[model samples]
Target: MTADLGHGVPEPATTAATGGRPEGHLGAAGPAPQVVLNLARPWGEADPLDLAGAALGAGLDGVTLADSPRLFPDCLLETGRILANTGARLAGPCVLSLGLRHPATVAGALGTLAAHHPGRLLAVVGRGESSVRNEGLAVPSLRTHRESLDRLRELLDDRAPELRLLGAASGPRTIRATAARLGGVLVDVGADPAVLGKAVRLVRAERPEAEIWVFLRAVLTRTAAEADAAGRPVLGSCASRLVRAPDWYDLPAELLPRVEAVAAAHDYRRHGTPAARGGAGRSPETERLVRDRFLLTGDERRIAGQLAAVRGLGVDGVVLAGALTGVVERLNKLATAVRAGLAIDPAVRTGPAADPAAGPAVRHRPDRRGRNLSAESEE
Candidate 1:
């Protein structure tokens, strides 16, 4: 699939490549970055399918399920259930740790999901954390990650899943491998513009046509204090990754110790939870610094500005890690921010903006069997 590099903004090629028409494809539709909801289960109290339905209803681009079986439900099973029920395209089970499942097993499960939801599923694999850490397994090296991805790709060759397999990469080596071998690279770092831009440039340099997706922690608050409060818990997840590899991010020297503190105190059992107070030791001043630097936060207007800045960096899409509480409400706010951000460019925000309370129009495509797979009926 060709990367949409027009206007210096990256756009998803899946719709064009798969012969499906999503709301905003390349060309006149404008480069509206695909907004994928990260439905990492067990974090939220609501049912996963219900969240998927609500997100799709809100007109978000797609949904990604976490692949941590011990902490969350089975990703493949939940994905099939979501596809069977909603029109939203699926992008996970992301970060499938090579240490837990063999390449063949992972490929078989992915093949089955794609076969059932052809043209609407994307597989993202990586050397995962939390999932493997909790089980006492070592996270695979970059070499293992690349080799596993290669083996999985070869395994699905004849089966014809007809889907793109993306690699979740952050470091230089893994990013280059993803560009050369996989369908694309999903940047695993939190939403830091500098880091994201560097990652995008590296992948684009290696393969100009490769798709780039970024994962960001999302929080909406009226004040900086509220932003810090809402963002502290989510930062735990980021700190966990950063602590393991300090050189991975371009962090300020003053904040390095805080990050290390969070990493040293991290508990796998509380991974991705609001209760995960890895940042407890951080000074209030330091916590605020981390929040301002790493998270996508602020009121609607501020968030709009931040997202517009992200779009300027040229990412194909952004996957938001949902807030711990009021998941649906936060998603609606995010959708609003995205719409508001697009409005920054009059040419990009076309048509009436979607109402946060009402369901947005979701387009559907036929599976191999020629059956319509949309949430709404066709005329």
Candidate 2:
């Protein structure tokens, strides 16, 4: 599917070449970076399960649902529906927060899901977001977060031995603690390569083998106005969650007030709407900071460059938050960008090409000399 990302930007040619496999391996790149969707607006106009199936169809690795019970749909129910509706082998959805819910309740829900779907169910818990705040509950302390994760992990083993427990970490203590305990750590710190690089180092320092996934606000366009409009809501909300502790970023003085303003003005009650979360982004400067250091918003090559930079830092995957609106097209556009270890992509086409599924026109593997020789030329 050739999706026009407005501005006449077509879907990445890599999407066609990989035959829509999210794990499209570019040789010697370790493995393709896992591209997953984290629904910033889970209960929006789109059906969550249909969105999950569409994501799987468009070469995405996984889907994670928002578990803000008071604010939206029941993530456990939605996750199970996706498992049942979508092809089990190709996908599963993670519940984004068990921080607010009791570990026993979470265990029971997941156990029931496992009994029905078995290996297709997945869970990732975090110190809750809207799920906590919207209900007037205090954000769990780091120690409380650690305890909740441990109990959930233990309970899941009895009911669903195959279930993997991944925890989310946005700060130093949580990053260290989650790494020591969970199967993987969803690093939701920031999208900046530098921050992610530091986060990657921190995760590995605690547990070398931990799976590290960074959560990013991703946009597949280069228009400054469009990117700002699309990015502000999500990024502002993220700032509110992550920018509280000044030391978390060691943020500069100039950027400090801007980020702090965004954090302060973001309202979860009006979550995921441009109007509600338009904080410091009223100016180009704040938006640029977000684009450069906190979010992904640019043309395919620029986006690819950022992805490559992050991948170079040894990140395992990326969760595209606030992506449910145009999930499939955006992911397809990002397929080539998600590649690792290589600076230039062989699959990137300069002009129109035939559909790769047609069997003749396709991307060729890079040779040992690192040359991308086409099949037509190699023979």
The TM-scores of all predictions, comma-separated, are 0.80, 0.76
Candidate 1 residue pairs in clash (backbone atoms < 3 Å): none
Q: What does candidate 2's lDDT look like per residue over 93-171, in tens digits?
A: 3445656678888888878876786544546778777567667678777767767877876777678755545677777
TM-score, model 2 to reference: 0.76
Off by over 4 Å in 2: 1-30, 42-44, 88-95, 278-284, 323-331, 339-379
| Model 2 lowest lDDT segment of ten | 370-379
Model 1 Cα lDDT, one tens digit per residue, 273-305: 566555456566656655665677767787788
Q: Against the true structure, whose lDDT is highest?
A: 1
Once superposed on the true structure, which residue ranges of model 1 sit more than 4 Å away at CA? 1-23, 26-30, 244-248, 323-327, 342-379
Estimate every model's Cα lDDT from 0 to 1.
Answer: 0.63, 0.58
The best candidate by TM-score is: 1
Worst 10 residues of 1 by lDDT: 370-379
